[model samples]
Target: MKKLMMTATALALGAGMAAADTIRMGTEGAYPPYNFINDSGEVDGFERELGDELCKRAELTCEWVTNDWDSIIPNLVSGNYDTIIAGMTINDERDEVIDFTQNYTMPDPSAYLALSKDVDVDSGVVTAQTGTIQAAFVADSGATLVEFATPEETVAAVRNGEADAVLADKSYLVPIAEEDDSLVLLDREENINMGIGMGIRESDTELREKFDAAITSMKEDGSLNELIKKWDVGATFD
Candidate 1:
């Protein structure tokens, strides 16, 4: 009888813990306007703010953690974090590994930018950040693709003339090109549409559903639109 009572108490305790209503989220904290460390050494960005709002709407406490971009997905799958609020693009390749919430950001194209006027990006040699849709595009297009660890490295390759052009998200590259006159965005006839979404562990369909519902509600109520306008996010949703 004592053993049975103890087991019942443990089960009740476990249930209470599970119903605590806190969601821990992960982000790269290096991707600007999405998640990044500001001058104050604090994480602040569109995704961060949006995640906080979503948690509020869902009546859950949110804890944000900084993670490296390359390892974010792996850590998420390992249960190190409950959800990934990073500006992760939802691609078919990634879908094989993890499930994603309904896309919160609209799809935008990736483009090529170069620092050298004489370099012919049209000749089909380019560098892209590894594991991105842009890298896949370059590979499929038969370009001599050089993979870089980060966007900064890809941009530096272009500046140093080591690469003919750097392919990245147009929204990010456009602001960078505008800031640095040495780089020019190539006028391409084709652009790749990539939708960014929040990631969750494959088994966490319940959490993903909550996120999707919250995002859909925000979108319907104009809160999401207000956030986009406040952050000046380059893309818009239909």
Candidate 2:
């Protein structure tokens, strides 16, 4: 979930330019497994590790840039960064503004989470991160869609009764549900699944091709599967 995008050109104008050789990798350092800041106060998670490897394979110098999820794309277009290695789904709405490398991770399921299993996930109030496919689905489902800026806040909204349920990526909610007896994932699953990919400016076709090749190489060599299993993020890219 995130804030809506501004014009790509306008957003790009707001950000400072990056150097030629160094690709600035932007990410939302809050989502765990997929991405998050670790004890060392650095971007330390699945994407970080995967990103570093991709850069190595592509022979591209890279630097990490932590950003809020809401403005991640706009900032990329504005020139603040070169690529978004965050767990961003490849979807039609987003593809219109920025190009994505071939998917790096397989499609992940979206599920509803609630304090109890009996809540009507289809009809009751549902919360999701703003600007996400989950939020869009909830909006169109006729359920009351409450949106928060962060995934953590969406879960909190459900716990606090501000919303009856929270809809989000199953991998994200799985550990939380396992850790807390009060939280339960509903049986219903939303059909808005999409593979996650790296976001790049549309103008950077050559850069996209380089990362694409790196991703393909990892897939062929089985290193990509290793990372997926190591992080427990989701299934491998097909």
Each prediction's whole-model lDDT (CA): 0.75, 0.85
**Candidate 2, which segments miss by more than 4 Å at Cα?**
1-19
* CA deviation > 4 Å runs, candidate 1: 1-21, 122-124
Clashing residue pairs in candidate 2 are 2-130, 11-78, 12-78
- For residues 1-238, what per-residue lDDT tens digits would candidate 1 score against the true structure? 0111112112221211243345678987866767788889878999989998887665567788887776778888876877888778898888999888898887767778987555666565699877777888888785789998677888988888788898887766777889999898888723665677888877777567667778888888778888887776656665
Worst 10 residues of 2 by lDDT: 1-10
Please give the range of 10 consecutive residues that has the lowest summed lDDT in model 1: 1-10
lDDT of 2 by residue, 90-179 (tens): 999999999999988888899889998899877889999988999999999878899999999999998899999999999899999999
lDDT of 1 at 30: 68
lDDT comparing candidate 1 with the true structure = 0.75
Q: What is candidate 2's CA lDDT for residue 35?
A: 92
Task: lDDT for model 2, please.
Answer: 0.85
Error of 1 at 151 (Å): 1.4
Give the candidate number with the greatest TM-score: 2
